[model samples]
Target: MKQTEAQWQSTLRFAVGVTAAFVLCEFLKWLPSFLAAALVAALLGNLPIRPPAKVAIGLLVTISVSALGAFLLSVWFRGMPFVMFGLLAVWMLLAFHKMLGGGSPLPPLLMLICLATIPVITLTAPAYADVLPIALVRGMVVALAIIYLVWLPWPAVQPPKPKPLPPPRETSTLRLALLATAVILPLMLVFLLFGLADVLPVMIASLMIVANFDPRAGGRQALALIVANFGGGMCGMLLYIALSTTPSLWFLAGLLFFATLAFGARISAGGPTAPVYVIACNAMLIIFGSSLGDSAGSFSLWVTRVFQFTVAGTFAVGMMELAWHPPVRLLPLRAGRSSGSSPGKT
Candidate 1:
């Protein structure tokens, strides 16, 4: 009973925190505002306990490095596609390798986010490229600030730390990183070649899918990711419509608070599906938040955005299936075991 109460408290805390973060982002009119809310959600979901002050510093440094690295790479290799891709691939490989080897995912994920967004934005909008690093840094600052503010009122009860698992072998980490790189690089190349800057959401979704992907879980996980993304899209659609009718920030805040409460409940429930719900909520936030100031925020565009996410999800799944094949021997072993058991049953 005590545990259940804690869960409810956590859920309520998350809803309030994220909603406040989103509202602040809107009021401040931050560039790429969805990012601030999304980061807050990620932090709240992943770190139940309050993080050390160094975490914010570490995040800032990571963002700075990634942004600087990407900017330099784009400028130096603007004329050499092959060289640019090669370097980008190397950075991705390193990031993925670190992530797979039990390093803090934020650094690698941030590296990927910067790698994905900065270069693409540079290619599509050179002027905006200079501005994005500032925006990213600002977003991280706001997110961390919100996290701290929220924690003051609703401090998380620190759970007992589990024994750390041994890191994966270098070979295994390398293989997984290569696989991840393979999955994302193509999409990055597609965006860069076609200059599909407007459809950046799809690329972002692909990055999220690839970041959380695990080969051992296989096709089921892939499908779950797709479904979760769509669930988020549905939430975003509903919120968009509600805001459209009322067109008031208070109304938007109230709607977001309630909607997040629903998602936070599922997240705090503690099951395999909890992660799925997290992804859904994130999708909803990104979709809904980004659409706020757009002039062409029509129903058709909204539906198209959802469809774009679906395509991104489907593509990631297809890539996963192609890249990750389970051992055929396991299938036969299971079949033989079943056959032997059947005879005993008879």
Candidate 2:
């Protein structure tokens, strides 16, 4: 009974917090407004307790430094495509290695995001390159503020934290890094080659999928990810349609509150599918927040965005399968069969 009560408390907290963050961002017309709400949802859903001040500070510092470094590097290497891509690949590999090797995930994740985003933005829209880093910093600042404020009123019941997983062996870590690079680089190249800033979310989604993927879980988790993306897209579409009918910030907030409550229930259920709901909520925020900012909010644009996310999820899943079960695995399998057939000869 106590556990059930705690679960409901957490659910209400998540719903209220996410809704408040989204409404505030929309009202203020913050650039990259979705980021604040998404971050709030992530923190509230994943962490049972509010993060310490020191950890929050460290994260902000990491975000700022990584974004600045990536932006500067992109600017310096704007004229050299091959050199830029080579360096970016190296950076990505190192980040993935650190993440897989039990290092703090935020630094590497921020580094990877900055590395992917800054270079592409620099290449395609040089004028907007300077703005990207600043916007990221500001979004993070807002997210942090929202996190603290919401936590004050709706503190979660402090469950015992789970033990952190042991790091993979060095060889395994390296292999995982290579796999991540393999999954990301091709998609990054496509965006860079075409300068497709409009569909930037696709690359971001691919990166997130790669970061969260587990080889042991395999295709089941992969399918869940794809389904989550579509589910989120559908939610975004529904929210947009509802907003169209009323077209008020308060109404938007109410819609978000109710919608988040539904998502929050799933998230608070604490099962395998919890992570899927989290992803779906973040996806909904990204799509809804960005579209809300646009003046036109065209139906075709929403369709295109949904299609892009689906394609990106599919591509990432395929790459992961290929990576996890490489051609080399077949040689071992064949050798095992041959040895089994001639067991007496051995």
Per-model lDDT:
0.78, 0.78
Q: Which portions of model 2 miss their true places by more than 4 Å?
A: 1-3, 161-171, 326-346
- By summed lDDT, the worst window of 10 consecutive residues in model 2 runs over 162-171
lDDT of 1 by residue, 48-113 (tens): 677798887898789888988898898888888789989999999999899777756777887888
- In model 1, pairs of residues that clash are none
